[model samples]
Target: MKRSKQWDVRGAVGFAAFFHFLYSCATGCLLPFLTLYLRHLGLTAVMTGTIMAVKHLVALAWRPLSCILARRHNKRRTVITGSLVCSAAVALTLLLFPPTGNSTENKSCNISQLNNVPTTLRPRTTLQKFSPSVRYSAEHTINPIQKHNSTEYISAVPVNISTLHNNQSTAETTTSSRSDGKNSSDVQKPSAGKRSRSLMKREQKQEKITKIQYQFLESLKVMDTQQQMFFFIMMIMILWEILAAPLTWAADDGLHEYLDFVDATERHRAVKPWKLLGAAGGIGCSGILVSVLYCLIGTVLHFYAYALLMGLAVPLAALLPLYRHKREHVPGAGVKALQLVRGDSQAMLCAITAVLTGMAGSAVSDFLLWQLQDHNATELQMGIIMAVVPLCQAAFAPLNGCLSRLLKFHGRLLPLAILGLSLQCLSYSFLQTPWTILPSQVLAGISIGALWWSLEAQSADIASPGTELAVKRVFEGLYLDLGAGLGSVAGGFVVQKFGINTLFQGTAAVLGLWCVTLAMLQWRIPRQRRINYSRLLAADASEMSESESEQDNDWLEKAMEEDKGNNNWRRLD
Candidate 1:
């Protein structure tokens, strides 16, 4: 039985990891570089933004539907189906993409461009940025990216994702502040007196810097795991705009497409392009062969045509997770414990991530499309700018060991990382046009790195000691998916209503609030009482300690008895 269970764990974990990686590559990696693709396809900024944002809405809607299907049928089979769906969507999008429209003819694209704003996002984040326990008082809700001049004092923090990208800790390298760059909150404050710690008998007082560090560390520790997860998920969605959102954001080549369409119309004017006997849908192509071709060829394009491939990636992303599932397995003990977290945490993360993805991605795409509606950017230039964040993050994340060593502890590391990202994002509140969005992508790597590190590290701390490592990995996966779903929905709506810059600042506000929440949690929720488990799961730490001591004494007594018996026999002999 144990052997079977062990095999199940190994199998489940391996398959899940495979599915997740494939899904991630298809969803995040591909989409991160999508912004430039939509521009090449004749999409206007608003149209591109809408396409990017709307797709997320579809993907978000699909996540639960997919979840349900997975539950009712074989989970692995469902994931497999999902992966195929992504492939199909990619093909369909490519085939249906309209030919150039006529300039003289009245034409409309479903998506529009929004200029005067910058930085779009993609839909694929997996969780929130902070724990739920952290709450922001109404006081810190300042929106730096707002048009109102009152809070405009907060200068935009552009992320140079290209900076130090060669470093292994992508998060550490990217989340840094510009040397002369100022955050909205960097205004000098009245100095506080020094303090002393009980741990150190020295009479030396605490420095202001030490106080901030202490407060910051405490704040980082206090955030509720749930809230942190929420913030982490949301932040990733916001960062999603770093690249792919631009695919939808660039200025529409309406006239360019119209000219091409006019030429096509002229060519076909003499004899209509008639539908062939075996034509699939409205296009003259076979469905089966076409789909397979897209899946195979699309993967190829995704690797090579960084800009053009995103249009395909948007739809394809929806399906990859499904196929990857066939490879997934659950650990022996985790299968049971995961049951406890199956719906609540998973659902919350997915829902929030989707909404945020839409919010950030839609808004930024709109802004960029508006900026580029005249089509000033060449595809290559846009692609490189969009490419920076993911490229930097991918390069840096693996070097977490080196980054961790730089920090004194995880508490310091995670929060500093979070703050650095927030500051990087906040920098965008006041930057000028054109170059505005470009710099922020660099920061995305750091923000994403910080958010991911905190959640994975903290979840490990929270999981039951008996649970296998697989449980936490699953926890990370589910939360990430949920967050991605929710972020898309939220991001889309927010972009539609508020401008893209507002969405960016709005995200910063959320991050700031998360910071406050962390502080509150640290102050109130004592370090010993981290997870507030139900009585059944909450094994009192003191009780466990006592039980362990008692067990140890029993073993000691048994050993002493044996030793004494042996000694007596030897003495008698």
Candidate 2:
């Protein structure tokens, strides 16, 4: 029996780790390239920003609701598996709508003619309207003439002019003869109108042909396709996010519950590092795979890779050893979570810190690729930079556990993590080359890891039994969804207006100020005034006992009498 139980534990941990690894593999494959794919589809920076912002905003509202429903129905495993399967299905659907336009043709044309156009003519609307036709006529009229000598070209021009004159005279003579009974003025008017109409028709035909050729040459067809599909894509992405938003939270919560059931709660930290390691491996490997496939096939296969990995993870998610607790519906769970946040100063501070950190992180993640591209970084270089972050995170995952323990005693890690984030943002502002940004990612991994660890620890300290999931939902909604949504929208506008550099600098300044304020508040607040779940739980327990309830009633009456005598209860802090 003991051997079988041990085997069950090993299997549970192995399956959990494998599931997380696969899930991270899918996420890493998809997210890093999603914006790039949108750009490839010919979306503008602002449009991409809006789509990303909407995705986060939807997650903010949906994550908590999904968690609540899952818990209430005791379907945590079902939710995880369903979300993974649905998200993978959606990801695979993307392959059906490949981006339009031929990049090679556009490059060839742009190099031959468009690049030779003067900068002054580039921005003129009229030039844009007429340049294609002019180029088409120039190519056709000049190419054949160039094949002959200069004498033949010069002689050919006069012959063409003489023939045009002869045709015009014949047409006039025919018109005059036909209208001999009519007045000369009336005959000339009809002839002139006919000539103008014919010329207009010819010009219209030429213009249509030129426009089509230009669109084909410049690959603007891609933009047209994107415009037509933009709304559909947005809806698909929103649905994907709605399904994906609660997955990590649900998995973590279920894992903890399982650990509690198995009397192995102490191993929670050890188990968590596996997820990080999986994430690191997934991100690094996916980056390499994408770069290799892009080079060899000149096509993106990441979406396919994402779908395969996520599909594989679904079965593992179903097999996870989640311990579902039997409980009646508790409608006040959210209310209690809110009350805990309000009562605990540390919890309130943690929430604010989460928001600020999320905002800064989103701004950097969403726009840094654009900056790198502007500096002419290649796909491989960008992949390397992205892979470095997760690798560093995985490398430092054990250190994070140790730091969480040391900082839990004094509750100093959150503020320090915020400070580290500020420094990272500041470093981003000064980036001169793509490779120059690599060092900053070390700071990024460490700070973000520490920030999340401290926030989780603090939340655990404040949450009572039965309110854990609700409390986690509140914090994650604030951090991942609300803060990130706002940051994406604002970052888009800022990058469009002042540029990405300014956006980074401004975010850094705001984070630095917030970090200082948090540190100061923590230092100034008295320990006695700070609230924790232990005090609240003790008071509730005492209230439930008859003797203690009577004693509390007597003490309350005495307090009321004192308040009546001195009005101390009404005094404002």
| lDDT at residue 104 of model 2 (Cα atoms) | 15
Which stretch of 10 consecutive residues in model 2 shows the poorest summed lDDT?
150-159
Query: How accurate locally, in lDDT, is each candidate?
Result: 0.40, 0.69
Show the colliding residue pairs in model 2.
Answer: none
Off by over 4 Å in 1: 1-30, 33-82, 99-375, 402-411, 429-439, 465-498, 529-573
Q: Write the per-residue lDDT of candidate 2 for residues 32-68, one digit (tens) a residue.
A: 7677666555455677778888999988778778877
Superposed Cα deviation of residue 358, candidate 2 (Å): 0.5
Query: Residue 111 of model 2: what lDDT?
Result: 33
Model 2, runs deviating above 4 Å: 1-7, 96-227, 327-331, 404-410, 528-573
* CA error at residue 502 for candidate 1, angstroms: 3.3
- Report the CA-based lDDT of candidate 2 relative to the real structure: 0.69
